[model samples]
Target: MSFRIVDLAETGSTNDWIADHPEDGLWVRADRQTAGRGRRARAWTSDIGNLFTSTFAAPQPGEGAAPQLSFVAANALLDTVARWVPRERLSLKWPNDLMLDGMKVAGILLEGHARGVIIGVGVNLAHFPEGTERPATSLAAAGIAPPSAREACGTLAEAFAAHRRRWREDGFAATRADWLAAAAGIGKPIVARLGNADLTGTFEGLAEDGALLLRLPDGALRPIHAGEVFTLGDQA
Candidate 1:
């Protein structure tokens, strides 16, 4: 599908703009966001020179669950960032986060709208917030010249379109395979924080439907439908 880009000097949040205008194939980009947020409504620092963009795509039948789109976004993000930096330096964190040298440099937030789902992506192009819950880094911090927000957004749209088409045609199996190949800390000990409780397990892999497969101490695999996953030290 073709995308129409709307470049905004400033906005409350690119995702919010996309939410308001739920047009299929519409890309909303902002130089900076006043009220940017990540998963679970966590505030995202939208410093200028970073890339904050969101796109609206109508849901389709037989396209798998809405949550699986996170994988699609993650794959596209990996491709987008690889254009500048070495692909080996980038890895995908669970759900929808892009890591640079083991630090989070980008994130994807998927929200359901009236028309479909609004996917908001934030990339630390030239700047990254300090003292975040987890460590963060940017392309510039990695010693690579970062692309402009507009340039990055354009590349993102193209990559997103390609992955989305693959999703529509090839289904989640193909996307899941690629995601696992670039996944970080697989087979390592990790903790999945499910709000009030934390479950320790091994990062086995992903289920057929994209649920995180957490191997427990009892030799059973628990499919995590939703939670905050973090790789832990050798304590599991």
Candidate 2:
């Protein structure tokens, strides 16, 4: 069973709430998040009628890299969207950002715990904040039929459950293939913004542990651990 709330405001982040006020699977929806966040503390819009969801899972033992959870979560979002859109059109950006026709449709953030993992996912299901130069998308804007917030979150959770099971058995190799098959930019020139330092290189694809493979100008292959990467328009 899933524990859900209807009208919550901001309180730092929803993942924090799931950590302290633990539940089986808490679905926290806020009317307005004063300080909604994304990767690297970017301001996330929490406008009404959009999806602001976070799911906390009890941890399980695993052998592969721990950070593969983001891949699993990203693929889960893609899987859910495939129920409506053509799966071939879905692809994953560096990390777990979801792309459709090269524009960002949704993205995921995964937080780990001692006994469980809290995954915070924010999807632009309806609207986006204005003045944002970065391209943003919505489910309805993308031609997907509208559904209630509860229904959308439930659908993603169901899809995530199935992908999580595959992550347990198949390892990152299988995860990378699934993501690459639907990738928007596989081999192309792109710029990687890793904070601290930025590198421009050719986007080769994903490594075994989910890191992006970048072939620099020197003909040297670089494996990026985690960074904000932008695939050129051509790649997209």
Candidate 3:
């Protein structure tokens, strides 16, 4: 499907703007966001040099579950980033974050609306927020000059289209395999913060349906569908 790209010099949030203007195959991008946000409504630092964009796309007939798109978006974003950085240095974090050399370099936020699902992506191309919950890094800091926000949006649109097709044709099994192969912290000790409660366990592989399979100390397994996950020893 062809995408309608809307580039704004500044906005409150690309995701919010997309939400207001819901249309399938519409891509909203902003040079800077005054009120950008991530999952859980956490404020995202929207500097001028980074990439802030969101796109609207219909879910496959049988594959509209929210979490599924997170994986698809992760795969797409990872694929786009791989073009500029070494694949070995990039990894997919559970739920919807991208890691570069063990630090967060990009994040994905999925929201469902009447028109379609909004896939909000924020990539640290030229700058990353400091003193954040997790360590953040930018592509420029890693010695790579990323494409402009507009250019990156075009690349992301193409990549997302391809991955979306792959998911539709092969189902979650295919996306799951690809996501796991690039997953970080698998089989490692980690902490999952669910509201006021925090659960510590080994980061088992993802369930077939996309839930996080966390193996606790008592030899029991817990399927986490939502929460903030932090690898052991990583400052949260």
Q: Which ten residues in a row have the lowest lDDT in candidate 3?
A: 58-67
lDDT (10s digit) by residue, model 1, range 1-236: 89889999999999989889999889999998999999999999999999999998888765878888899999999999999999999999998999999999999999988678999999999999998888899999999999999999999999999999899899999999989999998999999989889999899999999999999999999999898898785222
State model 1's lDDT. Answer: 0.92
For all predictions, the C-alpha RMSD in Å is 1.7, 2.9, 1.2
Those runs of model 3 whose alpha carbons end farther than 4 Å from true positions after fitting are 62-64
Residue pairs in steric clash, candidate 3?
A: none
Question: For residue 93, what is the lDDT in candidate 2?
Answer: 81
Name the candidate, 2 or 3, with the larger lDDT value.
Answer: 3
After TM-score superposition, the amount by which residue 117's alpha carbon in candidate 1 deviates from its true location, in angstroms, is 0.3
lDDT of each: 0.92, 0.74, 0.89
**Candidate 3 lDDT for residue 57:** 75
TM-score for all predictions? 0.97, 0.87, 0.96
Kindly list the per-residue Cα lDDT of model 2 for residues 1-236, writing each as its tens digit. Answer: 34455336556667666667655456565545667778876888777667777877765555356688788888888887777778777777878788776678777877777766778887777775665546777767778775666677788877777777787777778877888877766787888877677788998988887888999999999999978887665323
- Candidate 1 to truth, TM: 0.97
Candidate 1, residue 56: how far the Cα is off, in Å: 0.5
Give the clash count for model 2.
0
